[model samples]
Target: MRLALAQLEIESAAVEDNRERAEAAVAEAADRGADLVALPEIFNVGYFAFDAYQRAAEPVEGPTLSRIADAAREHGIGVLAGSIVEDLAETESVETPADEGLANTSVLFDRDGRRLAVYRKHHLFGYESAEARMLVPGESLGVAEFEGATVGMTTCYDLRFPELYRDIAAEGADLILVPSAWPYPRVEHWQLLPRARAVENQLFVAAINGSGEFDDAELLGRSTVYDPWGTTLAGTGDDPDLVVTDVDLDRVAAVREEFPAWRDRRL
Candidate 1:
């Protein structure tokens, strides 16, 4: 499968501008022959924009995801609508983690614009941030069958937890998409975690981060895709970019068979 990771230029609290850029990226990726395109976390509202979280929060089927679903259908390519600040109370279409609160959420759409999965971020960042206090944690894992592969979704801070990836791997996931808003100074961690998850889980791990700056933080772009063998197939520096790469779905099984480390897990 051909995958495109969109490292978008996100501006704090600029909902309309961010959404436009995300849609444009999807169109460009489709034109570039991508079968699927994944976006960064909170592409609609910048992740560091804590004050705007409440105002920008929308339901799973709201305007942001609705436009993304339309773009997927128009382009005839699958899309992982990176993520948004979801207003759980207003969302009646899906089962929310909380009845009346905000959550970090992502939605997946097929080429026909069908809602395939909704993944609220399981892990909320707490270190020097307001995300944990402002959002409700996701209670379920997001996995779906798309094209010829099983895809899983996770957010930024979730990369630090390998157990989540292992659980998804147990669910027969072949590829995992990480929608992140990772910042500067921790470039090494951003680089290490996703590759490790790919190697240990014997699956593709694509870490998609955004670009641009906020008042207190600046997004460190560096969106990357790793094969089952932990090889960097495609990547970019700290800038808005479209990182596309072809991945063989069969590689997951081949790597697992060769290493057999996943099967030996006693814990």
Candidate 2:
């Protein structure tokens, strides 16, 4: 499968501009022959825009994801609408983690514009940030079958927890997509975690981050895709880019059979 990771240039509280760029990227990715394209976390309302979270919040099937689904159908490519600030109170289509608060949520759309999965961020960032206190945590894992492969979804801070990836791997997931809004000074952690998860889980892990700066933070955009063997198939520097690469779905099973590391897990 050909996957595209769009490292978008996000502006704090600039909902219209951000959504426009994201849709353009989707069209470009599809034109580039990508079967699926994934966006970064909170691509509409920048991650560091804490004050704007409540104002920019929308339901799971709000305008943001609705436009994304339309773009996917128009381009005839699957899309992971990276994530949006979800107004759980207004969200009635899906089971929300909370009823009165906001949550970091992502939605996946098929080529035909059908909703496939909804993944609220399980691990909310708490270190020097307002994320944990501002949003409700997701209770369920997001996994779905798409294009002959089982795909799993996780958000930025979730990369620090390997147990989540292990659980998804145990669910027979072939590829994991991480929609992140990682910032500077943690570049090493951003680089290390995804590769480790891919190698250990024997599956593809694509870490998609955003670009541009906020008032108190700057998103370090080194979007990347790692194969089952922990090899970097395609990656970009800390800038706005669309990283695309072909991944063999069969490689997941083949590598697991050859390495047998995952099979040896006793605990």
lDDT of each: 0.95, 0.95
What is the C-alpha lDDT profile of model 2 across 224-260, one tens digit per residue? 9999999999999998999999989999989989999
lDDT of 1 by residue, 64-166 (tens): 9999999999999999998999999999989887789999999989999899999999988999999999999998999999987899999999999999999
Model 2 misplaced regions, further than 4 Å: none
Cα-based TM-score, every candidate: 0.99, 0.99
Model 1 regions lying over 4 Å from their true place: none
Write down the TM-score for model 2.
0.99
What range of 10 consecutive residues in model 2 has the weakest lDDT sum?
A: 91-100
What would the C-alpha RMSD of candidate 2 be, to one decimal place?
A: 0.7
